[model samples]
Target: MQTGKIGVTTENIFPVIKKFLYSDHEIFLRELVSNAVDASQKLKTLAITGDFRGEQGDLAVRIKIDEKEGTLTISDNGIGMDAEEIDKYINQIAFSGVSDFMEKYQDKAEAIIGHFGLGFYSAFMVAKKVDIITKSYKEGAKAVKWSCDGSPEFTLEETEKESRGSDIVLHIDDDCKEFLQKSKIEELLNKYCKFMAVPVILGKKQEWKDGKMQDTDEDNVINSVAPLWSKSPSEIKDEDYKSFYRTLFPMNDEPLFWIHLNVDYPFNLTGILYFPRVKNNIELQRNKIQLYCNQVFVTDQVEGIVPEFLTLLHGVIDSPDIPLNVSRSYLQSDANVKKISSYITKKVADRLNGIFKDNRKDYEEKWEDLKLFVNYGMLSENDFYDRAKDFSLFTDVDGRHFTFEEYKTLIKDNQTDKDGQLVYLYATDKEEQFSYIEAAKAKGYSVLLTDGQLDVPAVSMLEQKFEKSRFVRVDSDTIDRIIAKDNAPELDLNETQRDILSEAFQSQVPKLDKSEFMVDVQAMGVDAQPVIITQNEYMRRMKEMSRYQQGMAFYGQMPDTYTLVLNSDHALVKKILSEGEASTKETLKPILSEIKGLQARQTILQQEQGKKKPEEITQEEKDDLSNTEQNLSKQREEKKQVIAGYAKDNGTIHQLIDLALLQNGMLKGASLNEFIKRSVNLIK
Candidate 1:
């Protein structure tokens, strides 16, 4: 037997180890179990390499608990160290100064284990003392017993051990007696080693016997040893992938599709990425992708490890290249992490492109669910956009899907305006915009369904991407004006007639909160409605964009401005114009005569003033000119009031405005109720 001090420069090494080894003391179980698995795997590798001539029998790592003895043991049939090997690896902790180390690294406890070779010392987190009993597989090697009691000194002595393996016994401290429970140790094993490369046996399989659950003779292996992701893609079936997905995320719905990632050259990355049914809640499915190293689970918060957009996907991403012992902030800055992120983005894009090329119908069938993800990718990753250009599709209101190029070719002849800009018509709500959609369809033009939450920003992006292209909501203008390809129809009303009708229609329009409406006259065929309401493209887009973006909130807060287009060619509008003309003639004749006289006097006064300097004009002449202008304005307003008074009593004018309002989904609340009341009264 031999007892000696640990080879450390500072006597404060033990306190530092206890204080600065791990963040969550619960993580100690993972580190210790991981070490045991590594040792067991090393033994198997040695046997395969012919370094060990002995039998590599039953290499199951077992964890045992003894509550009464207040002890927890992790044993493994792997490379066991003799006394000299223990002194070299265990006694001498490199570059450790107890006092300074504690002060510098005390706050960064989780970073200490993988930084230095202190995997064995993590046992001290929950245990007051730790003992290791082992016999090496080497020929003629004697058994060794090593013991440490939370100090820089340890005892290494020759002892008897029949098995060629190592058993780590931790005497659970009073503060950490929870680990001495069998169920607690089993839970930790399931969490950290459920999919480890080697089998992990906890205890005998239990059965309900004699009114209690008792252990059977068979060993209860806790892990599957080989998870589904580690297998070749060719060997996996659809059901296999589905079953594995359920195992990974039991509460989530089945995924829409999956991508198997296996790459070797640049950096080793292997795992399965699942496209879950995001169902308009992209945020809910985020952080579902777990990161693993060598089949040991690392973390699911893989924001920096994966592309920002790819985090919306759900699954596992196992990469040994990702640094494990660093904080998330550090991992995000690592160059290797960025490479992994770019690679994952490339893989996801490739998979989507492949699906599109092989099965377009299937792809389109899944497009509604895929829209949010694709829009997110296009918004975030430029390279992803460059790759997705060919496969990305724009779906129209007729339920037809077209690529960007295909749609451009399809509509280049019909929807291009006289200004040489391609006009792309779109509708946000198919039901609400049904009339506008039909009007656009009547003109032999296509209307896209841009109703997704991201479509507001995406439409702006597409307009920039497509050359000489612009997006017009179907209700943005009259169908003729939406795609102004040929000659515009003429409105034959004289200036007097146009003003009278414009004011007549404008006076009766409904008043709505956050709403502004303008009156414009258009000459449409008699088949069209007498009145129609449409919004302006630029203003509507600005308002829509304001919902997702800041700095443009002023646009959102502004009133919705709609154009009340009165169809002059329609029979009802022609009748109203004739009535307005007759009713306003008597009121306007006197006003027009006075306005002409006032304009003539003002022109004469200006001529008189032009002949003299500022002081030359008499005060009486200036007063006469000002009085003439005021009387002329009063006569004009009276003429306008006369026309408005006629319109106020005209049921046809009010009904036409209400019909247009109802068609555009603008009639609501009190106005809608009043329209219904007037509609019922008119029928009676």
Candidate 2:
């Protein structure tokens, strides 16, 4: 036997390989199995190309563990290398200047495994000694045995082999003895080679003979030669896709639908993306998509390869074009990767559009399950928005669905406001906003159910996309005010009467954290509730967006603001004005008179001053104006006390406010309890 140093400039290659060659030493098994797969695939290619005339008999790759000998071997029946090929590919260290390479790359040793075509050397990461015994398929080729003992030096000589193939034998180091375990090697094989094109046999098949586990003579193949995604879409059925989905995500619920991606034009990309039934719990369902390179599993964290939203989809994406091992920065900047991303986006949109066009009823039935994903795609990908624009639908509270264009036509005439804005009404909680929805329907308007996580941003996007169109929450305002075709009927009460009633209602407004209420007198025709709480759609949407967005945290931190609109036509409010409890009215009348007199004086002073600046006005005039404003403010405070007195005794006012609060799902804690109690008392 003759041995020569591995032609390299550095002596510490073994230690560097052990410590940093791969982030997870467990990956050594993957490397070995992958090499075996590549060998088997090469043999198949050679046979197809008419280079190999010999009968390709049983091209299965086998992994054998010899615990007694303290060795593991991966053997494949493929085109084994000759001495010349071995010297060129294995002996010569391709990386120039080993010492500098090690020092510069030690920190990234794990990342460097695949960079220098060092897949074979990765065996040294776990083994102290490695041996390759092979007989090439070429004519007049002799069998050879090559051995290395954890150093640059190696020995190569003639050997005896039964068949034309290669055997990679690894004498596992004492520190990595865990690899000796059968379960460990099997796990690695499953991870990296489960869907490879060639059969990967692990051990003998097990049988439950005699009601006990026993090994059979048959070889136990651990991989599928042809995975689901490799087949034509026409040949596959829904159950096949479902079965494949189970293979990818065993614990997940069955997917709602799947998109089989088979594209070979711009770039070779093939995969199946399944839309799982994600129910409100978002974090649990994310990061399910598995990314593969040439059928070898690379990562399930495919955020770099796929759009941020599509990461929620579960499946296997295999492409030789996408590099197996690279930094996220590399994938992001790679030209082919960008093309692949665009292709994926187009494919997903096309699949969705196809589903919408082929079976709209089925699409509508699945809309509730699909809304979150569609909304996410629309918000995250502009291309997706452009494609989904025609097929994307608006589902109403009554369960009827309409495309964006269809909905526009359905509600254009009635929902269009005097400002020529086509108002798109939507509700978050159908049950909670039932009254608002019904009121909108009464006015010949349809209310959409915009309740998904991405609906807030999507609504904002839709408003921008549709010209002269605005999205209004069903309960954001009264039906008449949401899309006013013409001016609303004027409230009959004069200035003094309106002032007294306004102060009476405003005084009783609840002081909750971060909450502000504005009292509005609406002639809502007595049939409406006395108090209806309406939120500003823009502010509410901004607050909702703040929940998911990072920079908008300030909006989320702020308390929700609502408008406390008082319907002047309601009987309770009319009674509050007409009956006016004596003790409360006595206290309120004088304060009202004082405020009216102060306001009259202030108006007279303002008219006299006319457009003049404070400096231009006389000191007496300025003082008179300031005193009138102060007296008016004080009188309003006094008036508030009278309304508070009436509110304290009047269950109707408290009940109305509580009802509005309950409608908005905002009445909580002790206040909610009080509202419940008041509701019960008022019903009695």
Candidate 3:
């Protein structure tokens, strides 16, 4: 036996390895297993290059747990290290054997994973002591044993061994005894080694024997030596891709489509990205894309590696060019990662475009599931938007689908306003906004169904992308105003009539929470509804954007402002105006006459004051002018009270206002019940 201190600059390297080597101690299993696989791969390369004439038998890496002994052993049938190699590789903490092997066999070695030699030290994270028994494949080579107890001091000795390989035995620490559990080891192997280059055996296959579960003699391999992404796309069938997807995510529904990424030049990359069925909540769909480096699993949280929008996709992305630290736990940003992101964005757009151009009907069938992803990419990535706009679809309320350009052409003739700005009318809810959608259709204008999770931001982006264009929700205003092609007709009403109508409707508007209504009388045709509720487009968009944007919280807190438009051409509005004048004209005449006299006196006093300088105006003249204004205000208040009284007793006014509220889906609780009762009475 030979004892020596590990050649390290720092004396406390073991403690750092045990405590701070990895973010998660569970990563120790991945590091050890990956090293074993690398050893196996090195041996294969040596044999292929005629360096080793020995027969290469089964190179499966095996993991075993001995709960009774409190030890976990990872054994491999690969090239093992003699005493000199162990002392050179193991004693020197940062010198990697794989790095030296790659330097010699760089052209022939397959998937050499170890870059930093620190992977072996990760074993100290969970093990109080570790032992390695290895024998070189060289003829007449002696087997060796190396032992370290979580310290720089280690023992190396010649030991008897049966075959050429390495057995890493870890005596788990007291606080880390969970690593001794069979289930825990199996879980780690499945997560980090499920797609490894070499076979990984966890335990024996289990079967029901004599009505009880028992381990069979067959080895239970946990990893696939050849995954779908590692293969050529032309050789794979559709079902094979789907089967791989099921292997990746068993509980998820079948993917809508997949993009096979196999780029070699500039930087090495290979993987399959599947377009998963995204639901209404975009957050739930994130972090599904698993990232790997040369078949070794890295992480699923690939936020920085992929673009923010591409995280919605699911499946695997394996790239040796992706930089990782020693632990291989997280990603490190570099030019390659950025290139990979741009490449993926382009691939996704190209896949979508191909699908749309080849089989548009099938693409349309999947649009409902694909909209959230496409819209997210369009809104977040400018380059992606430039590629995606040609294939991205706009589905209408009538269930017809059109590409962005196609929809623009379909509506360009009629939806353009008098100012030559193209208006894209959209409805959030097909049923809730059915009346507005129908009204838009009646005007021969197409209304898109922009109701996806990211549609609000996507529509905002489209407004900037399309020149001289704007997107307006169909229910945001009256159809004629939303896509006005001609000037609005003038209302034939005097100032008194306009004031009475405005006051009556405004008073009857319900006091809804977080809602404010402004009354406006418009000369819509007689076929229009008596009253329609319309939200302000800019304010409504700001509020919707606040749900996704961080700095727009102020807009979300403000009350929703809506316009309660009374159509003067409608018969109900006309009857209300005529009847109101007839019923209140007699009583309002004397009040109006008094108001007119006060206003005339107020105007004459204002004109007299305007003619004089501040020094020339007498205090009495100022007093008289102030008094006339007060009297005029009082007379107007009395007139408003009389009009409000008439409106309060008028069921038509209440019915019209309630109908507008119900149409907006805002009538709820007792108000909805009252609206229902009032509607029935009005019908009777």
> For residues 1-684, what per-residue lDDT tens digits would candidate 2 score against the true structure?
556888777988767765655666776776667666666666665666676788788887899999999999999987777776566657876532223333654543211113344567778888889999988888878888889998888998888887888999999999988889999888888887788777889889999999899999999899887889878999999898998888877888888888888987777788899988884567887768777666767667777678887777778887767754321112334778888888888888888899999999998888877877788888888888888888888988877889988888998987888999998999988988888888888767888997777777889988888899989998888888888867766789876556556666677667888888887777877777788888888788888878778999988887787888888888888887775545466676677777778888888889989988767999888888888898888887777676666656676777777778787777789888988887787689
- Superpose all Cα atoms of candidate 2 onto the true structure and report the RMSD in Å to 1 decimal: 5.4
Runs of candidate 2 exceeding 4 Å displacement: 12-23, 47-55, 94-116, 279-281, 326-332, 581-593, 604-625, 668-684
TM-scores, in order shown? 0.85, 0.89, 0.96
User: lDDT of all predictions, in order shown?
Assistant: 0.82, 0.78, 0.90
Off by over 4 Å in 1: 1-25, 66-72, 91-116, 120-162, 169-188, 206-214, 326-332, 591-640
In the range 399-431, model 3's lDDT, one tens digit per residue, is: 999888888888888889999999999988899
Using TM-score as the measure, name the better of candidate 1 and candidate 2. Answer: 2
TM value for model 1: 0.85
Return whichever of 2 and 3 wins on lDDT: 3
- Return whichever of 2 and 3 wins on TM-score: 3
Report, for all candidates in order, the number of backbone clashes.
Answer: 0, 1, 0
For this target, which candidate reaches the highest lDDT against the unseen true structure?
A: 3
Q: Give the TM-score of candidate 2.
A: 0.89
Q: How far in Å is the alpha carbon of 538 misplaced in model 1?
A: 2.1
Candidate of highest TM-score: 3
